[model samples]
Target: MTGSSHFPVRGIIEGFYGLFYTAPERNDLISFIADHGFNLYIYGPKNDRQHRARWREPYPDFIMKQFAETVAHSMNRGIEFCYSIGSGVSINYASEEDFRLITSKYQAFYDIGVRHFMIMLDDIAAEFHHEEEQLMFNSYAGAHVYTANRLFHWLKSLDKSCKLSLCPTDYHGRAPFSDYIHELGKGLDQEIDIFYTGPEICSETISEQDTADFAAAVQRKPVIWDNYPVNDLAMKSEMHIGPITGRESSLPRVCKGFIVNTMSQAEASKIALLTFAEYFKNPDCYEPWPSWEKALKTIAGEESYESIKLFAENSLYSCLGYPEAALLDLLANKALFSLRSGEAASVSKDVQKLFDYLDSLDEAGYHLKYRMSNYALRNNLVPWIEIMESLAWAGRRAIAVLRALENNEDITAPLNWLKESVSEIRRHPKRYTGSILLPLIEYVESKVD
Candidate 1:
């Protein structure tokens, strides 16, 4: 039986809004989200006076005004705005200053048009073992509470209302899911309408059972910082990049809500999410989108998700400062296909271009030169090589289709390419570290051994 009813899917939204405030990127990003089907957009600009400095002071009026206009555009497009306020973002605020900063951040957002806001406390705190770090953690957690509680009080203090979503400061790197959940729940302002991640955000593995449990435990109307829409449940690399939707694990849940977090990696592939939504709304739409040409004018817009994603990958590595993330992170996410990879022929011609492109790029061992997104494909060569090796795997699949056209399946041509890739890895073992490379290495060693 299909597990379609495990979770009731909602219309879809976001908990974080990536920023490129120094230029026109932010404007482009917001418009992109609206075209796709996200109704909520959280504003988390990297650095600005409203967040980095004391709230008692004025934020540069021009930036502030422009930001408000951006929010207005979001609302006009039917998107809800969630504004983030705090100094920990820049890692430089003390308690009183954090209070001053977050308070103003929230107020500024609310004044503009935000009905939702997020308070990030656990993150600013440092290593708990260090006295100074512990002090920072405490101060940071307090400021979160100060902002959160005050937010509740402020709502009571005024007729204006909002839905407060708070994140535990130590969230990104924490374990003992229970402790994290408990601490977050204990400190949760009674007025808080939702918790950001709860216990379901996966960094290493995407387990349906775990998501089910997190939903059960967090009785509040749960809202998640859905990372599957990006890539995780493995190291922060791109081993098995697929599409942007988390269809396999998420479509069957009956819960509060979900807010996907888009980044430079997945935002460009917004169609993935829209495709996922169509399936969630009606699985037959599970069929691959016709084309970005169709999807962009219809769902994703302009370029196909494949081209947009490639552009993002090249943009990151070739242009953006954070050349550390990868495109595969966005591609290999299996949850995208309702957790199923359909027949290649079934996928749109534009969507299929990615595989064709990878198949053709020059290869050295398993590492092929991807020049699309600049330095954004920052995953270790291990994953890159694996995909390169998977060229062997991807090629095997391709052979069945190609062999009929041409006799003598000279898989050796690509196989030789694979051998060269393995040899390159052996030649530069130091370049490939960690446990990820082992499988690809062993796959090749077995050939020689």
Candidate 2:
């Protein structure tokens, strides 16, 4: 399906490595995407054996029926359901039988009412496997170009309105285009869209200049395969629950829309996906924080918004970088500054306020664990909540120890509690990413010692 004015060609690609979404979850997500104005959904979970590992095989009857139903569901909602195949793992690029096998797979999906198609050659060995393929093609680029071009023509012959896209092996970088990309850019059909993930697979920012440079190298505007909020690979322990950042506003002018690589957790993914919709709809005027807060309120429900926000703020660290928790850090330092400057009496109220805030965060953690509607989010955040609660307990004990010392009362027990709480936080089983409390814990430890 082609992009229209009301809806950009933007969509979500279920392209994460672990834990494929269930059929129900996929259906729910499609509905969510339609409600939020996203126009496409690419079904390409990396772990789906048929989609990647066994790319040339047709789906079983049950699976095919589900996919057909999904395509119909998306069509009813004005969303294009793109079927993606990653056949590069074991395809004999030079063989006509291999081409026919791949074509047959696409034709099956085409019969299922899917007109949008993608061929993903990402994350495969760069070398050809068969001697015949090596002899027939000069390089890996030639193989991919030949396969993609052949498929493009075959699909066009069947239906001219069919949209085709490709994800090259060398899909990211700044300079010195790989022979694969260079050859594909020169030889591949220009009508087929190309997918790029900026300078790196999980890039910090996608700038207009960088995209323009990539477009120049590829001989076509790239459809950004944005990997924001996808915590697969080494980032599996983390959940990216923050607003999308670092992407410049003018990106749409240079690239052909984006397809967000969403997390496996469907419900939590909507938080970031909502913001992506906002950014794609009006890149020039998008404000992440406002969109983020609205998304939380809408997704988490008003009653549970504050608790979800409390958990989400701590989970904002992604491959791009940590979100600025400058205000909290500054307040924490200020409280310590008061103690060091011998102005404890003057800033006692501010210290109390900071302590209260931290305490409330601990309470919010409890609420998130027991009360939030999203079980996956709660499960993912349990470790972080434990850390936050331990830190809060430690912070309060440190304050108590300080107050005891100032008043010249017995301080041994509170000091020991502070030490134990700090130990609890440091020894927690799960390592939370981008912890804002670490610095505060360090400061408290210094003061207690």
Candidate 3:
């Protein structure tokens, strides 16, 4: 909790595009973040029409009640609940009526004790859509800064405690950014924080120098809107249960805050968020694997650790960059190397180790399917777990076929089973142990002729 060491804002934003979390889920996450020493939570899911598409409108009474409860619960847990609105999708920045509508929307939340807000102009066209906006402002950034600055002043007038953040259209890339962003940096209120998503929207690596360069361009320290472990849109097939990686420990020096964009599965997202909690706690000494193992133990619990670890290792590939199924890759490579060397003793030992790992992968899926106490996590992982089992089965069958050939035995049964397992794996789009599994199967198939 010391100011000198940790990020000013360390939290998760339930800001994915499709199928936002339910009220209960958000409440649970708020409590979870508080326990992990995180200090902020932003609500800005794109699918919530009232929060995005219908930004000018107030939330219905029932939904407003849920938001009130969520805000109250967050405050109770010592977490700041930042209500975010995606207004750029259809905002008429020049219209006084539109400005009033946007402020009125925040006024409702303010009444419910919300003092933190974000005006999101992301994922929208940079060009002005309205005639009035085009005539009033020279560029996209000009219109956005005009609205944001006005909002900041009005919010300050209502309450000096009000905190506002603005997400610029050109929110990512190496600096100096687009003219829009440079203009945003110069024109936007300095008191208001700007959101920047590293070198790319879904950046693989966020270096210290890159962040410093961006801060220089923005004319203020930017709050990192880190997009990781968020499997939505085109990435619907992924299950990102891996650790946080590629972010420099020196990031806190250049950035104002750090916030993760989470996946649709609330419980599963906690696995990655827990690692994020560790990183933000003491970024200087954070090690991805150790932090990841600790996160698995803390969130998944001891009973399901091995199973969840195996599952997580296979599901690690995302935009954040990780070697998928690292353990399996190691063992498979060792076995393949031994096989190539024609060392019978080494081959027997290494190949058996690989086979054992594959066996465990299959067993882990089966055990988690029926035995995992966390039903929500289990449900979220079902698709990937099934694929894990399929890949394991395929690996085992491939090994069996290879062994049978070595012994001069008929490969019919094992070969047929291998084909069946591969077929099962390919039927679904879910990925686990992705690149390694297919090449191993192809290598075994190469042995057949």
Q: Against the true structure, whose TM-score is highest? A: 3
Taking all chains together, each candidate's TM-score versus the true structure is: 0.55, 0.89, 0.94
Pairs of residues clashing in candidate 2:
none
Which candidate model has the greater lDDT, 1 or 2?
2
Question: What tens digits encode model 2's per-residue C-alpha lDDT throughout 1-449?
Answer: 22234235788999999998999889989999998778899989999998889887788999999998999999999889999998888888988998898889999999989998999899988997889988898888888888899899999999998988999999998866776677889998999999889989999998999889889888988889999989887877676778888899878677888899998778889899989888877777789999999998888778789877766765666767755444556667777767666755224876787788778878888887888887766665676678767867877777777777767878789888988987886777544433555555566566556
Q: What lDDT does the true structure give each of the candidates?
A: 0.44, 0.82, 0.87
Q: If ranked by lDDT, best first, what sequence of candidates would result?
A: 3, 2, 1
Comparison by TM-score, 2 against 3, better one:
3
Give per-residue lDDT, candidate 2, residue 5: 43
Better of 1 and 3 by TM-score: 3
Residue 388 alpha-carbon offset, candidate 1, angstroms: 9.3
In the predicted model 3, the residue pairs found to clash are none
**Please, what are the lDDT tens digits per residue for candidate 1 over residues 91-160?**
4333466455556666766777777766554334342333444455564444444456766666445445
Model 1: per-residue Cα lDDT at residue 437: 27
